[model samples]
Target: MRVGGTGHRLLHAETARMVERALHERLARLPADVLVGVSSLADGADQLFAEAILALGGSLEVVLPASRYREALPAECLGAYDRLLASATVVERLAYEDSTSEAHMEAGRMVVDRSDVLVAVWDGHPARGVGGTGDVVAYARKRGVPVEVVWPRGAAR
Candidate 1:
């Protein structure tokens, strides 16, 4: 089973923990032996889901939005990003020269395309920009991929 992840980068401290627990609980229900997680390895929700996948002994696949994707992420996210990237079972980097909104949306599309299901840690709000979590969730729904939303009750961004 291949699963893809999309969610916010900025999260409240308590909300982050809520999201982490929610993601782990949801992911734990999957069949571990054949599980493969696809993600951009961004901070917050992406990293949380990746960590859960690893904890459950599932394989991870990373998709890079652009050649300079790593440099575009927040400095604080670099440590987990580096570790997740290093732990990925497969990594696919796009041909974009820069890590623009377009690159991110394309990366989201790639994740949706490669996944059997899309897991979203969304709060049901519209996307702040062109390539935010909402857009990815919308795209996944449009493509008929099953989506399991992992937003915990009372969680806030």
Candidate 2:
């Protein structure tokens, strides 16, 4: 099964660990042989999910929002992003040259399209910006994609 998710960028350390454990538990419930995870490898939840997938021996498929994704990402996120990209089974970089909001939304769309299940690490809030996690979750729901939200107790952005 293909799984994808959207989450916050500024997750607290305790919250990150909780998210990771939740992802691990979720993946453990699935058949490991055909497991494929799709993600943008963003700073917080995305990165945690990717790591969980890899730990469980699941393949990773990375979807970059734009050509300049590396430059546009926060500096703290760059290392994890690069590491995940290097380990990815497939890396799809959107045609956009710049990392604009449009590009981000398009990338989110692609993630939902490629996923059999969309895992959202949301806090039940409206989207804060054009292409935030909430927006992606809404898009996935609108498209009829099954979404599994993985926000653990005490988890905070």
Per-prediction TM-score to the true structure, in the order listed:
0.97, 0.96
| Candidate 1 lDDT by residue in tens digits, 56-110 | 8899999999999888888998999999999998999999989999999999999
lDDT of 1 at 41: 88
C-alpha lDDT score of every prediction, in listed order: 0.92, 0.89
Q: How accurate is candidate 1 locally (lDDT)?
A: 0.92
Locate the minimum summed-lDDT window of 10 residues in model 2: 4-13
In the range 1-157, model 2's lDDT, one tens digit per residue, is 9998778778999988898899899888888888999998878888988998898989999999988878988898888888899999999999999988888888889999999999988888988889888899999999999989989999876
lDDT of 2 at 82: 89
